[model samples]
Target: MEGRAFTHTRRALWETRTTFETAPYGSIAAAYFAMWLGLRGIKLSAVILHDLATALGAKAVARATQYFLQSLRPEVGSQPVHGWDSLIFLIIYSVIVFLPLWWLADLRWARGAVYRYRATTRTTKALHFCAEAYSRPPGKRTSQLRDLESGLRAAENAILRAHRYAGTFPRRSPRSAAVRAHAALVAGALRAESLKIDADPNATLPRLGAMLAVIGERCAEGRIGAMLSEEFLAEATPVSLTRTAIRESVHVIVVVTAAMVAAVGGSSALRALGVNDDLRPWLIAGCSVVAAIVVGGWHRVGRLLELMPGK
Candidate 1:
């Protein structure tokens, strides 16, 4: 039962990857474009509101900003805009409106959609391959299975290392370090498994199980275990882990892009409305802080996703 389950899971993962790789560029492009459009809409709306508040009535602008700041409690420091006075109303209003839209479009909706799509596609392919491999006579396929298991283990180890090192190094460090580590590990594991299969066409299920146990034990001792529970490790196949990691990478990209777009739009909208000239410095500072938080949070989420079962 365990062998059958593992094979099924791997085949599913391979199928999922194949689907993603084959997807029309236009479809993916459209999804990303929609995210941008949503962000732009929010920015435009905020700008219009800011202009209306400023030109139509200063008191109205002040009241609106106050309400927004009070409600949102943005980390605006002790500046003129942060005060009860209406001077920075337009800026505050823009931020209040745009921040939520950005969050909704990028972090919540778009990210979820992307993650689910990738996960489904990758898992499908992996499981298909696993099933095919397992269907072969045990004596004929033992070596191949062993090699595959080893490759998978190596890849898993690399991914764990990348996760651990994330945010630990300086800002200027190459982004590919983590990615490379993961890739190397995956390649090594796959290579080992392939070799084993070539050497021995007929391998037993017990040997395969032992190989899995070895990898699982090593992974559990590493930082990778912190993110993935023993239950997940025991049940998950190599294909699933790889697929999950890829899906998570997509989410990170979407979320980070959305946050950046929001920051720029929010800043621009605030400036256009001329809501808080006196509190300009503080407002900028506050926005910077918020942007940092968003980016940091997005990174953490990506890491967590990578650690999850069933990529």
Candidate 2:
């Protein structure tokens, strides 16, 4: 009966640890809500919907390419193209249309709002666990010690993840540097506490707990994640509604206009080269594929700039 009880206790502790480790994902919804609330008063621009614009631009480019190809081979235009050829074109189009959006979304800053909130929540919770452990008597501290250790580890992971996006162009801010140093301190302290606990299961972590309390206090005071306050509001660039509308209108017009011009120029270039009518369709397809790749790469590069942390 004693052995079974020990097994159950260990299993419970393991489950708690697992919960702490996966806590960041659950924190995402809260973070998103915090971010939305922060930006609620401000009018968001279509810039946030850049992925949609890129998709529309890709479609326009594809349509223009197709129109030009058909014009080049009026004789063969009547013949049904092979299924394989259409499928290949579609694959190329999809890559051009979706790859950039995926790349942009994958970047760390794309989720900065959530990461910031998670980091703050983790740090605060770690401090709470530490305080609880510190106040408890040594004889009754095993569970609290385990929870404190788990919380500290979770906080460290969250802080490091937030640290990744806490930089501006070319360099990180002083606040970010401090946060990173704090994360390193947490790592060292957690390790020391873990070693002490391994030596004696009932060991107290007063020093580690005290240190983490200071860090959490700083976080609450706007050192890291700004405690999800007005700092989040500052993250969004303030642009007039008129300017935003004009910017979006210009973006749509430019993308579509560029697509049409490129198609016309490409068709004229192929004609000047005296390319055979029989081969023009394949050549146009190849060129469209190349253009799609270049455009996708360009979009990815543009989105990568978002990785730079906002002030």
Candidate 3:
């Protein structure tokens, strides 16, 4: 729809610099608005709402967490400088300190959010429409029903082929391959159900319609079920868990090392900024503990890693 467009929220360096420094609110507002508008149609609103809720929940947790962390730090240098000067420092400090923690929390929730979003997009509206056609009077729907039935068989064969090929990826990308296998199984079941329908003499629309409705419902559910396939979960679980564990351990180590070093240098650093550091121990411990907690929430953080591309 355009020759040159900037759909991405982040672009040029100057724009990013200005946005982050002067009004991060603009960035936040743009992101929120874009999410709503981008997903306004095509039936993904539920996914968006879920993500919003997850983010809100993460924010609430991050707020409490940051408050507790602040309490653990020295109050000596925290006295206000007053006016906009103080605000600038506070903004910088908040970005430097709390944002990363909140971002990690958000990343945790974004995993489920992405999976739900992708699953929601794979709808069965076309199948429902075909169901309606199949429900019509026999004389009127013969040709359409025949074509639809043939199409279903073709789709089933294609999906079965895909399922067979999935084994090749079981060791490489088991999660996605498992989804295909699950979807293929469900599709196969639906095909068998359709094949079971009696085309007896003078069969009524009521019987045909019921079977079609069943097919339609199954069509809708199969895709979502694939997204949550047990086999896929089973095959992918160990890999994801291992990666998540290693990542979390590294994060904890980094946090502990960084905090301890910072606490050591904190006195000089604070003095340079005309402040003091009396709660070095508290700061070091709090930072280490908070970082560990952020990584240790396996259910939240682990799934987030699983959702990542090429994970």
Candidate 4:
């Protein structure tokens, strides 16, 4: 019976550890909210310019390539001849259709990243304060420690259950990376507190002070602390990791939207140009190539940025 009890206790601790390791959903929500506010702060002219450039570039390249291919093809039969003017018209129509959708999607993603970052920062601060308080001299310190542990356990379980739900739903994409980072910081702080508890579960004042000092120092210098500081300082300026994340998300949306517009517009242009049926495969292939280039380039750039220090 004792062995079974020990096993159950160990399992509970492990669950608590896992929960503490994950970043809280509240942090993620707040970070995204901040990003949304940042997006609103951007200049309207700049946003319009960005959209125009993307649309123009995509249309120009796609139309030019389509025309060049059409010139090489033999006139097999008298079908519909979609001239350059028709192709241009289709491109313009497609751009107008897709740009708004892309912009909104980008905005959503940017907001999410910001929310996660801010939330993590706040949670870390709270956890650090609690850890320090729990480490004070005995008497009140002991009571505080018990209360903190109890609170942490409850929070951890709730977070774990939320994480499980997040994992189960594709639409519920929780900011796992940020969550894990915060969780690590909390666990480290808790571990330091546990050391004090084991040294003198009776909660001696001197031991509590020493433990608090040591844990406080660790919390201040550890990964979580560093991340929090980085975010806080970054938010002070426009050119921070958070900004970069927003920009990258915007770029991706623009690129993907351009590709889709080009593909659809190119198809419509082909239909209008009276191009032969044999040319359909070539047109489809060309559209695929454009999409691949945009998507592949976006992926490479995002990966490179992620690999960069502080990103």
Clashes of each: 48, 0, 0, 20
lDDT per residue (tens digit) for residues 1-311 in model 1: 23334443344335435644334355456655775676555555545666777777766564554454443434555433333344355555455445544444334422332222332222223333344466777566555555444344333444444333222344456754544444344434433444555455346333333444433333322232232334433433344445656976776676566556665776687789786655654565466546645765633444544443222
Tens digit per residue, CA lDDT, model 4, 197-305? 6466555323333333332232222323232223223322222234444875787676667667777887788888887765664675578556746665644445444
Q: How close is candidate 2 to the true structure, as a TM-score?
A: 0.31
Q: Candidate 4, after superposition: displacement of residue 96 in Å? A: 32
The TM-score obtained by model 4 is 0.22
Error of 4 at 134 (Å): 48
Leading candidate by lDDT: 2
Candidate 3 local lDDT, 166-242, one digit each (tens): 23234455566555555555454545445444454134333333433333333223332342234323423122323
In candidate 3 the C-alpha lDDT for residue 159 amounts to: 38
Worst lDDT 10-window in candidate 3: 1-10
In order of lDDT, best first, we have: 2, 1, 4, 3
Off by over 4 Å in 3: 1-126, 150-171, 198-223, 226-311
Candidate lDDT (C-alpha), each? 0.45, 0.49, 0.41, 0.43
List candidate 1 segments past 4 Å from native.
1-190, 204-209, 221-311
User: Distance from true position, residue 57, model 2, in Å?
Assistant: 36
lDDT by residue (tens digit), candidate 2, 1-311: 11223343233234335634334454545555655563352223222333454577754444434533443354746745442345444454454444433433344344433333455556657767877876777678777777776686666555444455333322455666555544554444445554665455434455555444444444433355432223223333322334434864565455445545556676788889998765665666556545544544434333333443321
**Candidate 2 ranges with C-alpha deviation above 4 Å:** 1-114, 165-182, 197-204, 220-311
